[model samples]
Target: MLGAVERPQAWPSFLHQVGVIELGKDRIEGSRLLVVASQANRGATFIAQSVTKQGLMRSYVQNGNPPWLFEFFVNESSNL
Candidate 1:
């Protein structure tokens, strides 16, 4: 989760509602940062988890030196 001080000052409320917030200036080898969060429902959880998986897949496709490996599981109803 991004700290309050790190969050954008003029962020959109709708983005927050959908669970996407804090597009940071930081980067990994020039790739911009994208932070997602959800404080409420299962829809938010799905967005967060889906974005995470897509990001990982993108990284693996772009860079495969050591072969990126990771595992995650999310059950939206329980927000696990």
Candidate 2:
């Protein structure tokens, strides 16, 4: 079975705080987001999605607070 690989240096620091969620490399469409392909801790694959830096910033402003995307992604991944 494949395990979560070390995050790329380019990945944002915020990703380190999300515990153990694995993401795919490709973004959906031109949207600034990636698919949360699998959840390591849960040992389950998922179709949920998370946003990229630009998307996160958008969410941060929309949410009006910290934890920019923790809440949004913790539940289920969705298209941008």
Each model's RMSD to truth, in Å?
A: 12.2, 14.0
- Steric clashes per prediction: 0, 2
User: Which digits, one per residue and each the tens of the lDDT, describe model 2 over residues 15-40?
Assistant: 55333333332333443333453453
Highest TM-score scorer: 1
Taking the tens digit of each residue's C-alpha lDDT, what string does model 1 give over 18-59?
A: 244323433335654445545445454644565587654454
Each model's TM-score? 0.22, 0.16
State in Å the error of residue 63, model 1. 26
Worst 10 residues of 1 by lDDT: 65-74
Candidate 1 to truth, TM: 0.22
Q: Candidate 2: minimum summed lDDT over ten consecutive residues — where? A: 41-50
In model 2, what are the clashing residue pairs, if there are any?
48-77, 49-77
lDDT of each: 0.43, 0.39
